[model samples]
Target: MLAALHLIFPPRCIGCGGAVTDDFGLCAACWRETDFISGLVCDKCGVPLPGKNEGRAELCDECLTIARPWDRGRAAILYRDTGRRLVLALKHGDRLDLVPPLGAWLARAAEPILLPDMLVAPVPLHRWRLLKRRYNQAALLSGALARAAGLDHCPDLLARPRPTPSQEGRGREARFANMADAIQVARRRQGQIMGRPVLIVDDVMTSGATLAAAADACLAAGAASVSVAVLARVAKEG
Candidate 1:
Protein backbone atom coordinates (compact mmCIF):
# COMPACT_ATOMS: atom_id res chain seq x y z
CA MET A 1 0.00 0.00 0.00
CA LEU A 2 2.77 2.42 0.94
CA ALA A 3 4.69 1.46 -2.18
CA ALA A 4 1.64 2.11 -4.31
CA LEU A 5 1.21 5.49 -2.68
CA HIS A 6 4.86 6.27 -3.32
CA LEU A 7 4.44 5.28 -6.94
CA ILE A 8 1.46 7.59 -7.21
CA PHE A 9 3.18 10.41 -5.32
CA PRO A 10 6.90 10.06 -4.92
CA PRO A 11 8.64 11.88 -2.12
CA ARG A 12 9.86 15.32 -3.15
CA CYS A 13 12.51 17.65 -1.83
CA ILE A 14 11.37 20.27 0.62
CA GLY A 15 13.45 22.99 -0.98
CA CYS A 16 12.40 22.21 -4.51
CA GLY A 17 9.66 20.09 -6.01
CA GLY A 18 12.12 17.51 -7.32
CA ALA A 19 11.78 13.82 -6.71
CA VAL A 20 13.83 12.44 -3.84
CA THR A 21 14.24 9.20 -1.94
CA ASP A 22 12.38 10.44 1.09
CA ASP A 23 10.03 13.17 2.21
CA PHE A 24 11.03 16.07 4.47
CA GLY A 25 14.44 16.39 2.87
CA LEU A 26 16.24 18.67 0.48
CA CYS A 27 17.74 17.50 -2.72
CA ALA A 28 21.52 17.45 -3.09
CA ALA A 29 21.54 20.65 -5.11
CA CYS A 30 19.36 22.48 -2.62
CA TRP A 31 21.33 20.97 0.27
CA ARG A 32 24.52 22.42 -1.17
CA GLU A 33 22.91 25.84 -1.37
CA THR A 34 21.77 25.72 2.26
CA ASP A 35 24.18 27.25 4.75
CA PHE A 36 23.77 25.12 7.82
CA ILE A 37 25.56 26.62 10.83
CA SER A 38 28.18 24.41 12.44
CA GLY A 39 31.49 24.75 14.29
CA LEU A 40 32.32 27.94 16.23
CA VAL A 41 29.36 30.28 16.82
CA CYS A 42 28.34 33.11 19.08
CA ASP A 43 27.27 31.62 22.39
CA LYS A 44 24.45 34.13 22.70
CA CYS A 45 23.16 34.37 19.11
CA GLY A 46 24.44 31.30 17.23
CA VAL A 47 25.92 33.18 14.26
CA PRO A 48 28.81 31.31 12.71
CA LEU A 49 32.20 32.71 13.68
CA PRO A 50 35.53 32.63 11.84
CA GLY A 51 37.39 30.15 14.03
CA LYS A 52 37.39 26.56 15.16
CA ASN A 53 35.50 25.45 18.24
CA GLU A 54 37.89 25.49 21.20
CA GLY A 55 35.56 24.30 23.92
CA ARG A 56 34.76 27.86 24.89
CA ALA A 57 31.81 30.17 24.53
CA GLU A 58 32.33 33.16 22.25
CA LEU A 59 30.11 36.10 21.33
CA CYS A 60 29.74 37.80 18.00
CA ASP A 61 30.36 41.54 17.79
CA GLU A 62 26.65 42.27 18.00
CA CYS A 63 26.08 39.95 20.91
CA LEU A 64 29.07 41.47 22.70
CA THR A 65 27.51 44.92 22.56
CA ILE A 66 23.85 44.00 22.92
CA ALA A 67 22.09 43.07 26.13
CA ARG A 68 20.60 39.61 25.56
CA PRO A 69 18.05 38.54 28.15
CA TRP A 70 18.31 34.86 27.28
CA ASP A 71 21.12 32.78 28.79
CA ARG A 72 22.03 31.01 25.51
CA GLY A 73 20.94 30.56 21.92
CA ARG A 74 21.40 28.48 18.78
CA ALA A 75 20.36 28.70 15.11
CA ALA A 76 20.13 25.85 12.66
CA ILE A 77 21.03 27.82 9.56
CA LEU A 78 22.10 31.20 8.27
CA TYR A 79 19.12 33.15 6.94
CA ARG A 80 19.99 33.27 3.25
CA ASP A 81 19.82 31.16 0.14
CA THR A 82 17.98 27.91 0.72
CA GLY A 83 17.54 28.63 4.40
CA ARG A 84 15.71 31.87 3.71
CA ARG A 85 13.51 30.22 1.12
CA LEU A 86 12.57 27.43 3.51
CA VAL A 87 11.72 29.85 6.33
CA LEU A 88 9.59 32.10 4.12
CA ALA A 89 7.74 29.08 2.79
CA LEU A 90 6.91 27.87 6.25
CA LYS A 91 6.05 31.32 7.52
CA HIS A 92 4.03 32.79 4.64
CA GLY A 93 3.51 30.13 2.01
CA ASP A 94 1.68 27.76 4.37
CA ARG A 95 4.06 24.94 3.64
CA LEU A 96 3.06 23.05 6.75
CA ASP A 97 4.71 19.96 5.33
CA LEU A 98 8.08 21.54 5.98
CA VAL A 99 7.65 21.40 9.75
CA PRO A 100 9.22 17.99 10.31
CA PRO A 101 12.50 18.74 8.57
CA LEU A 102 12.75 22.25 9.97
CA GLY A 103 11.98 20.97 13.45
CA ALA A 104 14.68 18.33 13.14
CA TRP A 105 17.12 21.04 12.15
CA LEU A 106 16.07 23.14 15.14
CA ALA A 107 16.47 20.18 17.48
CA ARG A 108 20.03 19.61 16.26
CA ALA A 109 20.90 23.29 16.63
CA ALA A 110 19.35 23.48 20.11
CA GLU A 111 21.21 20.44 21.45
CA PRO A 112 23.91 22.59 23.02
CA ILE A 113 21.32 24.32 25.23
CA LEU A 114 18.75 21.58 25.82
CA LEU A 115 18.15 20.56 29.43
CA PRO A 116 16.29 17.56 30.74
CA ASP A 117 13.56 19.61 32.40
CA MET A 118 13.41 22.48 29.95
CA LEU A 119 9.97 23.69 28.86
CA VAL A 120 9.69 24.73 25.23
CA ALA A 121 7.61 27.64 24.03
CA PRO A 122 7.23 29.81 20.95
CA VAL A 123 7.28 33.56 20.68
CA PRO A 124 3.62 34.35 20.49
CA LEU A 125 1.95 36.12 17.60
CA HIS A 126 -0.51 38.93 18.09
CA ARG A 127 -4.11 37.80 17.99
CA TRP A 128 -4.82 39.66 14.77
CA ARG A 129 -1.77 38.26 13.02
CA LEU A 130 -2.60 34.75 14.22
CA LEU A 131 -6.08 35.13 12.87
CA LYS A 132 -4.81 36.17 9.48
CA ARG A 133 -1.98 33.65 9.19
CA ARG A 134 -4.10 30.77 10.42
CA TYR A 135 -1.04 29.36 12.18
CA ASN A 136 2.03 30.45 14.09
CA GLN A 137 5.16 29.14 12.42
CA ALA A 138 7.15 29.43 15.61
CA ALA A 139 4.64 27.38 17.51
CA LEU A 140 4.76 24.65 14.91
CA LEU A 141 8.54 24.57 15.05
CA SER A 142 8.57 24.61 18.83
CA GLY A 143 6.14 21.73 19.17
CA ALA A 144 8.12 19.61 16.73
CA LEU A 145 11.37 20.51 18.45
CA ALA A 146 9.95 19.65 21.87
CA ARG A 147 8.88 16.25 20.63
CA ALA A 148 12.24 15.63 19.00
CA ALA A 149 14.09 16.65 22.17
CA GLY A 150 11.71 14.82 24.47
CA LEU A 151 11.01 18.05 26.33
CA ASP A 152 7.70 19.48 27.51
CA HIS A 153 5.94 21.77 25.05
CA CYS A 154 3.86 24.75 26.21
CA PRO A 155 2.35 26.52 23.22
CA ASP A 156 0.47 29.06 25.34
CA LEU A 157 3.18 29.98 27.78
CA LEU A 158 3.51 33.42 26.27
CA ALA A 159 1.02 35.94 24.93
CA ARG A 160 1.07 39.06 22.84
CA PRO A 161 -1.63 41.26 24.21
CA ARG A 162 -1.24 43.96 21.58
CA PRO A 163 -0.07 44.08 18.02
CA THR A 164 3.15 45.80 17.05
CA PRO A 165 4.31 47.10 13.72
CA SER A 166 6.49 44.87 11.57
CA GLN A 167 10.16 45.11 12.46
CA GLU A 168 11.35 45.04 8.87
CA GLY A 169 13.88 47.71 7.84
CA ARG A 170 14.18 48.92 11.41
CA GLY A 171 17.50 49.58 13.12
CA ARG A 172 18.53 47.52 16.10
CA GLU A 173 17.59 50.01 18.76
CA ALA A 174 14.39 50.91 16.96
CA ARG A 175 13.39 47.28 16.73
CA PHE A 176 14.13 46.72 20.38
CA ALA A 177 12.11 49.75 21.38
CA ASN A 178 9.21 48.73 19.21
CA MET A 179 9.02 45.28 20.81
CA ALA A 180 9.33 46.49 24.39
CA ASP A 181 6.47 45.39 26.64
CA ALA A 182 4.80 43.67 23.70
CA ILE A 183 4.97 40.12 24.97
CA GLN A 184 4.25 38.54 28.34
CA VAL A 185 3.57 35.22 29.98
CA ALA A 186 -0.05 34.22 29.92
CA ARG A 187 -1.59 34.38 33.40
CA ARG A 188 -3.19 30.97 33.10
CA ARG A 189 0.07 29.30 32.05
CA GLN A 190 2.34 30.93 34.63
CA GLY A 191 2.55 27.76 36.65
CA GLN A 192 4.05 25.86 33.75
CA ILE A 193 6.84 28.44 33.35
CA MET A 194 7.56 29.32 36.98
CA GLY A 195 10.73 27.79 38.35
CA ARG A 196 11.43 26.05 35.06
CA PRO A 197 14.06 26.53 32.42
CA VAL A 198 12.36 27.72 29.25
CA LEU A 199 13.51 27.51 25.65
CA ILE A 200 11.83 29.99 23.35
CA VAL A 201 11.66 29.01 19.71
CA ASP A 202 11.26 31.27 16.74
CA ASP A 203 11.42 31.02 12.94
CA VAL A 204 14.12 33.63 12.49
CA MET A 205 16.18 36.12 14.49
CA THR A 206 17.05 39.37 12.79
CA SER A 207 17.43 42.19 15.32
CA GLY A 208 16.35 39.77 18.07
CA ALA A 209 13.94 42.24 19.56
CA THR A 210 11.06 39.76 19.48
CA LEU A 211 13.08 37.12 21.29
CA ALA A 212 14.27 39.54 23.97
CA ALA A 213 10.66 40.44 24.72
CA ALA A 214 9.70 36.80 25.05
CA ALA A 215 12.71 36.00 27.26
CA ASP A 216 11.98 38.96 29.50
CA ALA A 217 8.45 37.74 29.99
CA CYS A 218 9.73 34.29 30.98
CA LEU A 219 12.09 35.75 33.55
CA ALA A 220 9.37 38.03 34.89
CA ALA A 221 7.18 34.98 35.30
CA GLY A 222 9.85 33.44 37.58
CA ALA A 223 11.37 31.03 35.12
CA ALA A 224 14.64 29.68 36.47
CA SER A 225 16.42 30.56 33.21
CA VAL A 226 15.71 31.21 29.54
CA SER A 227 17.33 30.04 26.34
CA VAL A 228 16.44 30.43 22.67
CA ALA A 229 16.46 28.46 19.42
CA VAL A 230 15.69 29.61 15.93
CA LEU A 231 15.56 27.96 12.54
CA ALA A 232 17.59 30.76 10.97
CA ARG A 233 19.84 33.66 11.98
CA VAL A 234 20.48 36.75 9.93
CA ALA A 235 24.18 37.50 9.86
CA LYS A 236 25.73 40.76 8.79
CA GLU A 237 27.48 40.86 5.47
CA GLY A 238 31.23 41.32 5.48
Candidate 2:
Protein backbone atom coordinates (compact mmCIF):
# COMPACT_ATOMS: atom_id res chain seq x y z
CA MET A 1 0.00 0.00 0.00
CA LEU A 2 2.76 2.42 0.94
CA ALA A 3 4.70 1.41 -2.14
CA ALA A 4 1.66 2.09 -4.30
CA LEU A 5 1.26 5.47 -2.67
CA HIS A 6 4.92 6.22 -3.31
CA LEU A 7 4.53 5.17 -6.95
CA ILE A 8 1.54 7.47 -7.25
CA PHE A 9 3.34 10.34 -5.50
CA PRO A 10 7.06 10.05 -5.44
CA PRO A 11 9.00 11.96 -2.78
CA ARG A 12 9.82 15.56 -3.61
CA CYS A 13 12.46 17.82 -2.11
CA ILE A 14 11.20 20.19 0.52
CA GLY A 15 13.13 23.14 -0.88
CA CYS A 16 12.16 23.27 -4.55
CA GLY A 17 9.56 20.51 -5.18
CA GLY A 18 12.09 18.58 -7.24
CA ALA A 19 11.98 14.77 -7.14
CA VAL A 20 14.09 13.21 -4.40
CA THR A 21 14.79 9.76 -2.97
CA ASP A 22 13.14 10.46 0.42
CA ASP A 23 10.54 12.61 2.08
CA PHE A 24 11.11 15.71 4.24
CA GLY A 25 14.47 16.37 2.66
CA LEU A 26 16.09 18.90 0.34
CA CYS A 27 17.38 18.13 -3.13
CA ALA A 28 21.12 18.00 -3.71
CA ALA A 29 21.16 21.52 -5.04
CA CYS A 30 19.07 22.88 -2.18
CA TRP A 31 21.20 20.99 0.33
CA ARG A 32 24.31 22.55 -1.10
CA GLU A 33 22.75 25.98 -0.99
CA THR A 34 21.62 25.66 2.61
CA ASP A 35 24.12 27.06 5.14
CA PHE A 36 23.78 24.86 8.19
CA ILE A 37 25.62 26.29 11.19
CA SER A 38 28.22 24.06 12.81
CA GLY A 39 31.51 24.34 14.73
CA LEU A 40 32.35 27.49 16.71
CA VAL A 41 29.41 29.83 17.43
CA CYS A 42 28.46 32.59 19.80
CA ASP A 43 27.42 31.02 23.09
CA LYS A 44 24.55 33.47 23.50
CA CYS A 45 23.16 33.88 19.95
CA GLY A 46 24.41 30.84 17.97
CA VAL A 47 25.80 32.88 15.09
CA PRO A 48 28.69 31.07 13.46
CA LEU A 49 32.14 32.44 14.27
CA PRO A 50 35.36 32.31 12.26
CA GLY A 51 37.42 29.97 14.43
CA LYS A 52 37.66 26.27 15.14
CA ASN A 53 35.66 24.82 18.02
CA GLU A 54 37.57 25.07 21.25
CA GLY A 55 36.25 23.80 24.59
CA ARG A 56 35.09 27.23 25.61
CA ALA A 57 32.13 29.50 25.26
CA GLU A 58 32.62 32.60 23.09
CA LEU A 59 30.41 35.60 22.54
CA CYS A 60 29.78 37.41 19.30
CA ASP A 61 30.25 41.19 19.35
CA GLU A 62 26.51 41.77 19.25
CA CYS A 63 25.88 39.38 22.10
CA LEU A 64 28.59 41.02 24.17
CA THR A 65 27.14 44.49 23.66
CA ILE A 66 23.47 43.58 23.90
CA ALA A 67 21.63 42.38 26.95
CA ARG A 68 20.02 39.00 26.28
CA PRO A 69 17.76 37.73 29.03
CA TRP A 70 18.18 34.12 27.97
CA ASP A 71 21.08 32.13 29.37
CA ARG A 72 22.05 30.38 26.13
CA GLY A 73 20.99 29.94 22.50
CA ARG A 74 21.48 27.87 19.35
CA ALA A 75 20.43 28.15 15.72
CA ALA A 76 20.26 25.36 13.15
CA ILE A 77 21.08 27.43 10.09
CA LEU A 78 22.07 30.87 8.85
CA TYR A 79 19.08 32.80 7.51
CA ARG A 80 19.93 33.02 3.81
CA ASP A 81 19.66 31.04 0.60
CA THR A 82 17.67 27.83 1.09
CA GLY A 83 17.53 28.51 4.81
CA ARG A 84 15.59 31.72 4.27
CA ARG A 85 13.30 30.04 1.77
CA LEU A 86 12.48 27.22 4.19
CA VAL A 87 11.70 29.61 7.03
CA LEU A 88 9.50 31.86 4.91
CA ALA A 89 7.61 28.80 3.65
CA LEU A 90 6.93 27.57 7.16
CA LYS A 91 6.06 31.01 8.46
CA HIS A 92 3.96 32.64 5.72
CA GLY A 93 3.43 30.02 3.00
CA ASP A 94 1.71 27.48 5.31
CA ARG A 95 4.20 24.78 4.55
CA LEU A 96 3.26 22.52 7.46
CA ASP A 97 5.19 19.65 5.89
CA LEU A 98 8.45 21.45 6.64
CA VAL A 99 8.12 21.06 10.40
CA PRO A 100 9.60 17.59 10.76
CA PRO A 101 12.95 18.29 9.10
CA LEU A 102 13.15 21.81 10.54
CA GLY A 103 12.29 20.49 13.98
CA ALA A 104 14.94 17.80 13.65
CA TRP A 105 17.43 20.49 12.74
CA LEU A 106 16.41 22.56 15.74
CA ALA A 107 16.79 19.54 18.02
CA ARG A 108 20.30 18.93 16.78
CA ALA A 109 21.27 22.57 17.24
CA ALA A 110 19.80 22.68 20.74
CA GLU A 111 21.52 19.49 21.91
CA PRO A 112 24.27 21.55 23.47
CA ILE A 113 21.82 23.28 25.81
CA LEU A 114 19.21 20.56 26.42
CA LEU A 115 18.69 19.49 30.00
CA PRO A 116 16.89 16.46 31.39
CA ASP A 117 14.14 18.49 33.04
CA MET A 118 13.96 21.29 30.52
CA LEU A 119 10.55 22.41 29.25
CA VAL A 120 10.18 23.39 25.61
CA ALA A 121 7.91 26.25 24.62
CA PRO A 122 7.35 28.54 21.66
CA VAL A 123 7.33 32.31 21.53
CA PRO A 124 3.64 33.07 21.43
CA LEU A 125 1.88 34.87 18.64
CA HIS A 126 -0.68 37.58 19.27
CA ARG A 127 -4.23 36.26 19.27
CA TRP A 128 -5.13 38.27 16.19
CA ARG A 129 -2.13 36.98 14.27
CA LEU A 130 -2.88 33.44 15.41
CA LEU A 131 -6.43 33.83 14.17
CA LYS A 132 -5.28 34.96 10.76
CA ARG A 133 -2.44 32.44 10.42
CA ARG A 134 -4.49 29.45 11.62
CA TYR A 135 -1.46 28.02 13.37
CA ASN A 136 1.77 28.99 15.14
CA GLN A 137 4.89 27.84 13.35
CA ALA A 138 6.99 28.19 16.45
CA ALA A 139 4.59 26.01 18.41
CA LEU A 140 4.73 23.36 15.74
CA LEU A 141 8.52 23.40 15.83
CA SER A 142 8.64 23.36 19.61
CA GLY A 143 6.32 20.37 19.92
CA ALA A 144 8.32 18.39 17.40
CA LEU A 145 11.55 19.37 19.12
CA ALA A 146 10.22 18.25 22.51
CA ARG A 147 9.29 14.87 21.11
CA ALA A 148 12.66 14.48 19.42
CA ALA A 149 14.64 15.55 22.47
CA GLY A 150 12.55 13.68 25.07
CA LEU A 151 11.54 16.89 26.83
CA ASP A 152 8.25 18.20 28.14
CA HIS A 153 6.38 20.74 26.05
CA CYS A 154 3.77 23.36 26.93
CA PRO A 155 2.32 25.16 23.93
CA ASP A 156 0.55 27.69 26.14
CA LEU A 157 3.47 28.47 28.35
CA LEU A 158 3.61 32.03 27.07
CA ALA A 159 1.06 34.57 25.89
CA ARG A 160 1.08 37.73 23.82
CA PRO A 161 -1.62 39.91 25.32
CA ARG A 162 -1.05 42.81 22.98
CA PRO A 163 -0.31 42.84 19.28
CA THR A 164 2.81 44.59 18.09
CA PRO A 165 3.48 45.75 14.58
CA SER A 166 5.84 43.84 12.32
CA GLN A 167 9.57 44.23 12.96
CA GLU A 168 10.53 44.34 9.32
CA GLY A 169 12.92 47.14 8.29
CA ARG A 170 13.05 48.45 11.83
CA GLY A 171 16.32 49.51 13.35
CA ARG A 172 17.78 47.44 16.19
CA GLU A 173 16.71 49.67 19.07
CA ALA A 174 13.28 50.20 17.59
CA ARG A 175 12.74 46.50 17.32
CA PHE A 176 13.71 46.01 20.94
CA ALA A 177 11.45 48.85 22.05
CA ASN A 178 8.57 47.50 20.01
CA MET A 179 8.81 44.09 21.66
CA ALA A 180 9.34 45.24 25.23
CA ASP A 181 7.00 43.49 27.65
CA ALA A 182 4.88 42.28 24.74
CA ILE A 183 5.03 38.65 25.91
CA GLN A 184 4.40 37.04 29.23
CA VAL A 185 3.75 33.67 30.83
CA ALA A 186 0.18 32.49 30.47
CA ARG A 187 -1.37 32.86 33.90
CA ARG A 188 -3.14 29.52 33.83
CA ARG A 189 0.05 27.68 32.86
CA GLN A 190 2.42 29.36 35.28
CA GLY A 191 2.64 26.29 37.46
CA GLN A 192 4.11 24.26 34.63
CA ILE A 193 6.92 26.78 34.15
CA MET A 194 7.69 27.91 37.69
CA GLY A 195 10.99 26.57 38.97
CA ARG A 196 11.64 24.85 35.66
CA PRO A 197 14.19 25.44 32.96
CA VAL A 198 12.69 26.59 29.69
CA LEU A 199 13.84 26.41 26.07
CA ILE A 200 11.97 28.92 23.91
CA VAL A 201 11.69 28.01 20.24
CA ASP A 202 11.22 30.38 17.35
CA ASP A 203 11.36 30.23 13.54
CA VAL A 204 14.04 32.91 13.24
CA MET A 205 16.00 35.41 15.29
CA THR A 206 16.88 38.69 13.65
CA SER A 207 17.41 41.46 16.22
CA GLY A 208 16.93 39.10 19.17
CA ALA A 209 14.18 41.35 20.49
CA THR A 210 11.32 38.87 20.38
CA LEU A 211 13.31 36.16 22.11
CA ALA A 212 14.44 38.60 24.76
CA ALA A 213 10.86 39.52 25.57
CA ALA A 214 9.91 35.84 25.84
CA ALA A 215 12.92 35.13 28.03
CA ASP A 216 12.15 38.04 30.31
CA ALA A 217 8.65 36.68 30.78
CA CYS A 218 9.97 33.25 31.67
CA LEU A 219 12.40 34.69 34.18
CA ALA A 220 9.69 36.87 35.69
CA ALA A 221 7.51 33.79 36.04
CA GLY A 222 10.15 32.28 38.31
CA ALA A 223 11.61 29.87 35.80
CA ALA A 224 14.86 28.47 37.10
CA SER A 225 16.61 29.23 33.81
CA VAL A 226 15.82 30.24 30.26
CA SER A 227 17.43 29.39 26.93
CA VAL A 228 16.50 29.65 23.29
CA ALA A 229 16.54 27.70 20.01
CA VAL A 230 15.71 28.87 16.53
CA LEU A 231 15.60 27.26 13.10
CA ALA A 232 17.55 30.16 11.59
CA ARG A 233 19.70 33.09 12.73
CA VAL A 234 20.18 36.35 10.90
CA ALA A 235 23.88 37.06 10.79
CA LYS A 236 25.44 40.31 9.73
CA GLU A 237 27.16 40.46 6.36
CA GLY A 238 30.94 40.89 6.40
Across residues 35-79, which tens digit of lDDT does each residue of candidate 2 receive? 999999999999999999987999999999998999999999999
Give candidate 1's TM-score.
Answer: 0.98
* CA-lDDT, candidates in order: 0.95, 0.95
Give a tens-digit lDDT track for model 1, residues 9-121.
Answer: 99999998898888777899999999999999999999999989999999999999889999999999999999999999999999999999999999999999999799999
What TM-score do all the candidates reach, one by one? 0.98, 0.98
Q: Using alpha carbons, what is the TM-score of model 2?
A: 0.98
Global lDDT of model 1: 0.95
> Would you give me the overall lDDT of model 2?
0.95
Off by over 4 Å in 2: 1-4
